[model samples]
Target: MSARLRPLIAALALAAVASLTLGAAPAATAAPAPKPAGDDFPHPDLRLTYDATVRYRSEQAAIADGYQRTDECVEDPQLGGMGYHYVKPAHIGSTDPTRPAAILYEEDHKTGKRELVAVEWVVPNTGQSWPVLFGQPFDGPFDFEPVGPHYSLHAWIFKKNPSGVFSPYNPRVHCGPCPEGHAHP
Candidate 1:
C-alpha cells in the first residue's frame, strides 16, 4: 500500500477500535458508594485503633470526652449483648454522611463495664436510605434490631463482629446484667 494511504487507513482504524471498545462497556447500574467526607465535615476517624492515644476507652470515658449516651442502656439478651448509644457533639443534622460520630459500647457480660466495641456513623435520613449500608432499599432509615430505624453503619473497631465488620450488630457481642427475666444461654 502507499505510505500516504497507510497513515490515513491506520488513523481510521484506530478511531473505529476506540469507538467499539467504548461502546461495548456495560452500562453502570449504580454509582460507587461514597467514602467518609474528607475534611469537608470533620469527625474522629473511628477506624483508628482504640487505645490511650485515641479519645474514649469506655462508655464513661466516651462521656467524659464529651460523647453523650443517646438512650437508656439496654441489655440485648439474644446476642448476649449490651448496646450503649452515644453521639458525638457535632454529629447532628446532616453534616458528613460518613462521619464516625456515634459510639456503641459493647459491655462485657462478665465485667458489666462498657468497652468500645464499635464506632457508628449515622446519616439520620430515613428507612429508605438502607441500600448502601444494609444492601436493600426501604421506606426509612436502616434499623438495627432492638434499636429500630436509624440511618447508620457500624465498624467494630475495638472488637470483632461475627456477622460483619460493617454490620449493624455483632452476633458475638454480649450485654451483661440483662434486664429482669431476660437472661438466657
Candidate 2:
C-alpha cells in the first residue's frame, strides 16, 4: 500500500481499538446511601414476633433469648440447619393496645416443641415508627438451663419498612477485644 493510504489505515485501526476499549469498560455502579447518624437513625414502622425456648438459663433472660432467636432465624441451611427468616406483619399498626403487634414463634430444637417467644410493636414518632419489642426468652416464674446440647428455634415477624433495610452490624465498629469468649460485640 502507498504511504498516504497506510496513514489512513493506521488512524482507522487506532480509532477502532479505542472504541472497543471504551465499550468494554464496565459502567460505574452507584454507591449505597449512607445510614443516618445517632438518634437520626431511620425509624420505620416495624413489628417482630417469634417463639423462644431457653437452652441455658442466664440472669439476663431477655438478652439470651434475643440472641438465640436471632441466631436460629439467621442460621445457614447449608451449615446443617435452617437459616433466619424475616417476616412482615400482616398489617401496619402501632405499639398501642389498639394496633397489631409482632410475634415470634420459638421452639426447642432438641424436643421439637414450640412456644411463643417475643412481641414487638411499632410506635409512631414524627410520622415514622420505631420497633420496640419485649426482649427474648419470656421470663416466667421458672429459670432453667438446658440439660444437653440443645438449641432453640423461633419464627420472628416484622412489618416491612420501605426505608428500613437490614444490614449486619459491622464487626469493626468495636474497638477493644471482644468480651471474653464472645466473638463480636
Candidate 3:
C-alpha cells in the first residue's frame, strides 16, 4: 500500500473500532429499588405499644423532624373514619431496642387503637407538645405513646399541670406510682 493511503486506511480502521467499543458498553444499572416500605429494622418479631395518646405524639415529632412528609399525617377522612399513618424511614433510630424503629398510627375517634409502626428507634428531642410551634401555625391535638422500654419517659407528650408545665406531680407522668391503670409495660 502507498504510504499516504496506508495511513488513511489505518485511521478508518481505528474509527470503526472506536464506534464498536462505544456501543458495546452496558447501560448503567438502574438504582437499586428503594428500601421496601414497612420492612421492620433489625427484625419483625418484637413489637410493642406505649400509651395510645403518646403514640400519636411521637408521630407528630417524626413529621416535624422532616423525616417523613406532612401529608402522611393528614387524616384520611375517606376511610370512613379519620386515620393517619406514620411512616419512619430506615435511617431513623428505633425507640425499642428489641424491634426496629416504629411509625405511629392514630385511628381518629377511636380508643385503644393508638400504636407504633416499629421500623427503628425514635429519635430523641423529636417529641414536642401542642402550643409548641413545629411547622407553620400548628395548634395541636398532639398526642403520642411514650417511647417504650428504651427510656424512662413514657410516650413523648406527657400531661402538663393545669398550670401548663410538666410536673412530676402532674397526673400525666405515668411511671412510678402512677394513677390506677396508668402503668406502662
The TM-score values for the models, in the order shown, are 0.50, 0.23, 0.21
Global CA lDDT computed for model 2: 0.32
Candidate 2 Cα deviation (angstroms), residue 95: 2.3
Give lDDT tens digits, candidate 1, residues 22-136: 7886557656533321222122533232333134664666778677776455445454343777877576332233445677776666666676666665555543424343332
Assess each prediction's global lDDT (C-alpha) against the native: 0.55, 0.32, 0.34
Task: Write model 3 residue lDDT over 58-86, tens digit each, in one string.
Answer: 55565664445323332222221112334
In order, how many clashes per candidate? 11, 15, 29
RMSD of 1: 16.7
Error of 2 at 84 (Å): 7.3
Ranking by lDDT: 1, 3, 2
Runs of candidate 3 with Cα error greater than 4 angstroms are 1-59, 66-83, 92-101, 110-185
RMSD (CA, Å), each prediction: 16.7, 20.0, 18.8
Q: Provide the lowest-lDDT 10-residue window in model 3.
A: 166-175
Question: How much is the lDDT of residue 143 in candidate 1?
Answer: 59
lDDT of 3 at 66: 42
On a 0 to 100 scale, what is the lDDT of residue 146 in model 2? 23
Model 1: per-residue Cα lDDT at residue 69 = 78
